[model samples]
Target: MERDRNLMRDILLTLALILAIDAVVVGVFALLAYPWLTFVHAPIAAVVGTTAAPVARWLVVFLPVLALFVWAQLRFTRQELLADVPAGDATRDTHPDLHARFVRLCKQADMQPPDLAVVDRDVPNSFAVGGVTNATVVVSEGLRDALSDDELDAVLAHELAHVKNRDATVMTLASFLPALVSDDRKILNVDGGANLLVWFVLTFVLYLLASPSLPGALFSVSSVVGFVTLVAISVLGGGIILGVLTAPVVLLSRRLSESREFVADRAGAVLVGDPSALVTALEKLSDRGFELPDTDARTHYTGVDGLCFLPYGLDDTDASTDEDTFTVETRSHPPTHERVANLRALVDEL
Candidate 1:
């Protein structure tokens, strides 16, 4: 296809991010487990000398992490991807008209029709998952009720473009990294608040385990206070170090994600031969969007924000108060104004 360059570059970049995340996990766990790794160190030293033992220790942690990542990616089939994100099956038998429209669009793009899914919600949003042969387009009940037929087709075309360019699959693959440090499946920053809390607890437990005199802490209040301070210091110090290492991956993912939306906007317009329809669809969805509730389903939705028509289910929960910047860019999807502007530009060209 004409998009070969963009697709290849994104795939390479996603691979780099996956490797980098694995390295970070190994480095952190290795540092924490260093003292206890002495037994491992001794065996390696006996075979490869003391100088190489440290290198071997890191490899010991790294290899398993890399293996698990490879295994996980291979095993993450369409079934696994759809498991947490619940939806009802949509077939030609159930929705003949929708399927006919879908088939026509696929013919326009010279691709086969993907599987379809629908949700019975009042929200007018949609998302796509998997890629190529396994791809599935998911829509809400309110989407059909809210949009006119042309605007709805434009939105459908947009998601198909995502699948066509394989960006949906790329983002889906990249999501597994953030999912590692977080159970929330939040792509950006990986739910730092909860992960940090886990770090603190684990650090505290280790502090007690590594204590020089556990008997003293049994009676002394000062000893209890000292341990708390020590744990906090260690966790804080580690966060600073780890954050520096992870910043590149986060920034790159953000840049790629925003760019893909623009790419999909243009491609979708070309696919459907109607850019203005998509423009109106984008505006209506953003203007009338509702915040996603903080439920297990929301957690599932967060993982596939890049594929969703509205990022993170339109959950604009970011607190930009006091001009705080960290909470400003929570959504994996690009800003609405930017997307609209880009689509308008496409409308002019097409």
Candidate 2:
């Protein structure tokens, strides 16, 4: 319970940081774009005299282009956001009946039976997805063959632990904020002709907004300055709005992810009788070769790859040195040895 509270606190702090960054970025863009947009466009309008139209006309042209950019982005990111779980048929039943046992345990724990999938890969890995209703679990073919029945049970229980704690929802929501912020940033900056087109349209809008003097009002010295101020305000206002709105959300998500990992690890240990199996599993998985094939943008890592009971390390081999001599450092997963040691301590308490 205390651990859960700590995780919540950390997630909050992370969100605060994300929000701060968002504000700064939006504020800076507003300043630069506001002035450059006005300075360049005011002269063009003076020459063209077509600037009498309302800014709304320019916004109409901008909307479709922005919509296309957003459409393409969602098409790309939708996969990571959702996964298609393979139905557990005969092949899944071959896994020594751990599935049935796990489902029973989940029932006892009052958790849902997570959608189960098994990938035919050599890497020992597993991961869970979905929230309470949509959740599913996946294990690698390699993991099934690698562990003893007890260890496998422990692994399965760990995943169920994730489901029980509602960690799936926590992680998903945590990721969503960053995904949104990233998507927005991409929308604004991506050069699929959209940014250029939007800028052109926005410039036209600014010109229109500047060109019109109030009805029956004579043009005066202040009109030009007033137009410039309005343009600056709009640009800056847009950026600030985006940053202030999105930044905290992203930061909160990341912090939640880290905390949830810790909570899941602890809860997983409790679901199974002993933490030692998890400790051992982590050790074995980390030492074993665990690389997966690369696929373009899909390379963003997810699932049990982060949670496996393994001492994750790079293969340190050298032709020039003796066959027995090697050194490995720097790992994406937390050091397995440290994790095992910690788990052992945790087990002793149990």
Choose the strongest candidate by TM-score. 1
lDDT of 2: 0.53
lDDT of 2 by residue, 261-300 (tens): 5555666777777788887777676556544333211112
lDDT of 1: 0.66
> What C-alpha lDDT do the candidate models reach, one value each?
0.66, 0.53
Please report, as a residue range, the 10-residue window in candidate 2 with the lowest summed lDDT: 311-320
Tell me the deviation in Å of residue 80 in model 2: 3.5
Top lDDT: which candidate number?
A: 1
* Candidate 1 C-alpha error for residue 38, in Å: 4.8
